[model samples]
Target: MLHRLKEFYDGPNKDAKKFYNLVEEANQELYPGCTGFSKLPFTLRLYLLKCLHGWSNKSFTSLLKLLKEAMPELNIPPSYNKTKSTKIDACLNDYILFRNDHKDDDFCHTCGASRYIQSTEVDSELVPSKKQHRVSAKTLRHFPLIPRLKRLFMCSKTADSLRWHEEERSKDRKLRHPADGLA
Candidate 1:
């Protein structure tokens, strides 16, 4: 491992060393005192349960407070905000992704459909002084690929599994795996 680290540091590509450093830093911050592919931390497990059961913020907070009081030694986050995931909204009619250049667009360019649901309750006679709250017509949650891939590679078992084809594949001239047939 030390030899690999040294080679990475002295590699021709500067980004490779930088990426290696970042992965190592992430491993430390994520695992901390834990060793050898342990179970998910209590806080993370609780957060997952909250999300899965759709627990309200008040309920989740109460549970955390109770747990903290009962187990003073355990480190529990005050709220679920610590484990927030990324999400984005998109056009409902055309399914046009609203991001980057089209982030602020109020309507879809392809279908000309409104991005937000039109409020029918608002009275036109009493034009409100402040902007009315708008709800998205539809939402599409997208998980980023890089962070997930980094997490998979961080685990020794998963990393080895990812490279199984290359390291453990039969070298005989026979089509065993699907990839072996690729030109």
Candidate 2:
């Protein structure tokens, strides 16, 4: 298991090189001129495997375990770390443009209210703790929009209309997309 994990991370094989190249491009763009070592390659590889190969969160955690068992020297992030995945997913979402048409109000569209406070009785019954406590009550699984947009750009068979904005791209372009008009 350790040998296989190291092969995937540091081997000179074609697939390993491809993985290295992907991480290289991402880190170069994210931290220009950064040449120091980082654990990001491992993290990004996990993320890519999940995205490209459709690995579930549980599967991802298992991979980390295998890597740890084999290497015993790696610093894999903690299992079930919500913040790690959230930060990576947020970075991936930055390039996406929202297409939904909605009013700019804090109120919910369905309830037309500013907030939906849960009942204190229900909260106490569920928590049953005197001291304040925090818990993650929900997790949302979403297909990131930016990668879908990037795939459109990668395919040579796409219509020219998709690249129409490239010719008119400006260094300081303003209000070029609907999102730019958002408050």
Candidate 3:
């Protein structure tokens, strides 16, 4: 599956507008010292879209070369070590645009952890603990954690988290420490 997908990303497409536009625009301008048309031998627009699909930087270039059909002119972005901020921004924008098109807002997006809340008013007779301990991003403002808890899925840095860790540590200390200090 991975190999097949990689091939598709690097595959040639005569229908690519960006590539044609760049080529046409370059010839019209015919200006020197400017890369109006891609110096790349093959169409990079397809690979650019695929690169946004979240492949590793190395894999992206590897697949690009395959689709480029050995077009030495298919100048994809350089390696991360030599990467420039502007180029990165462009890559990210392309990725975001591609991603946005493929995403469904109504569907369960995997932006963060998955949680389901079920509220049931249990019978007051049988169950003892009436207190609810679970937290949710939806009810974060009501919780003591406030702003920090608002990002429940990514709340490792929250101030209240320290309290929880501290409490757990104390519990461990109790288990480790013997009443008679025999060890």
Candidate 4:
């Protein structure tokens, strides 16, 4: 593994080799991630994750040196020797992108709300869960998405007969006379 670590060269121009996801689009400009310390740039943050995944601290430190030799802008090279405070603080904000914490039900998939609507809600069938998910028969085999299906209930595009049952309470409240509030 040490031999391969020193020799491995995954770069943008080299499609034959696969770079880890964090570093896959290093050169591309991402929304500036949480301001991390160690003065390391976001791209270098990705590089460190790749190194830490497999290599030990000592080997990672050595590898960081080699990377430093190649790219002057990479800031501090991988430092397995650094204090835990320094190492931990350095990666604090960069993990946000990895976790995809921005998954909001309200603004999902801006293109056309891919997940929230179905053409035919009542007649739609549940997709069978992949066999890999079967731990025990007691576990839910197929959970149908109903709330997402509800959005289409309001739209009468495909189902001409579908009716939106709206309670006429809010409209009546707005039309009430001011004298109703007298004590």
Candidate 5:
């Protein structure tokens, strides 16, 4: 495994070969349940590698094609089309205020109001747990923006700019970045 890592580090065209091997190795190492890439029911490891590398579906597809040819012994997923579509469908399963139907019956049963219309309202602590239960399960998984913005500050390149809000504030200041928050 050390040899593979060293060879991978020194290898030319590092993007193509090393990524597949590393993903395969990591999958086997991390997940003891699955035997290897081919045996796993889901393409979770491949998806996670793409996420960690910040590769787009198209770029991952190209890499996957290269892997299929270079390592015939490895059983990798064929294309990104199905994988991407499935991910997209999963993400899109959540309801959007602007896009989804808002019939009057969708209102709160007790208050007869659309209290859960805005994402902020849905996520707010002010909303009772019982009321929260009234929200659609799909909408419950709506991704929060604050954590994602905070993650930007976690990166080395952006960490220096963590205090940019304070440094660059105007007289009529408004919250533009996550760093502006007291938390």
Candidate 6:
């Protein structure tokens, strides 16, 4: 199924060819010696399970340590926190996204709301502080889409399934899948 899909993508369509090449490159990086999930290494399988179950880094480390004690030759996988993510401070009142040019701004331009939580301590004659730690009033966590989409095409089974509508769908007048219906 994957071979047929690859052949179809490798045809005259330059965009499809580029997508196939990118997916192949990502697959090589993600699964080096393995072609599919069944052939993946024990450590990789554990890591996938850890990601799927949303296991904490500390919990995963503890599990790996226990596994190492039982199986001395077990290869330790890299940390699960390798995925890139960004946290942006947003306006609490106006719901304005403070990013890029407005990243360093102290207050929201739209609502005139302070970006950081107000300090509650009163100024005293005895104590004088130069700076106070500022916490964002609201934060938005962002995860990149391209890397995640690439991951979806990393596995042969997943890649084949994703392209099923284009590669394996019937060309007749009957509709079998959702892709067959006209929008």
All candidates' lDDT scores?
A: 0.68, 0.49, 0.40, 0.38, 0.50, 0.65
Expressed as tens digits, the lDDT of each residue in 35-115 for candidate 4 is 232232443464568667876767666776786678655554346453122111111222221113432322233332222
TM of each candidate vs. truth: 0.47, 0.30, 0.20, 0.22, 0.29, 0.36
Stretches off by above 4 angstroms in model 3 are: 1-48, 65-69, 73-183
Q: lDDT (0-100) at residue 141 of candidate 5? A: 21
Instruction: List runs of model 1 lying over 4 Å from the truth.
Output: 1-45, 63-85, 92-96, 99-101, 113-147, 154-156
Off by over 4 Å in 6: 1-86, 93-95, 99-101, 122-131, 155-183
Per-residue lDDT of 77-179 in model 6, one digit per residue for the tens?
3343422123568999855878767978999888899999998875665566645679899987543366556669998999999998789889896887777
lDDT of 6 at 26: 35
Instruction: List model 2 lDDT by residue over 1-183, tens digit each.
Output: 987887677548674575566444333322333333235544666778788998878887787778768866555554636315432111112332111232223234554433223334446666676554322222233334554466466667573668555654553648877644547
Best by TM-score: 1
How far is 170's C-alpha from truth in model 3 (Å)?
A: 78
* Cα-based lDDT at residue 81, candidate 4: 51
User: Global lDDT for candidate 3?
Assistant: 0.40
Ranking the candidates on TM-score from highest down gives: 1, 6, 2, 5, 4, 3
Q: Give the TM-score of candidate 4.
A: 0.22
Native RMSD of candidate 2 (Å): 17.2
- TM-score of model number 5: 0.29
* Candidate 6 residue-wise lDDT at 116: 91
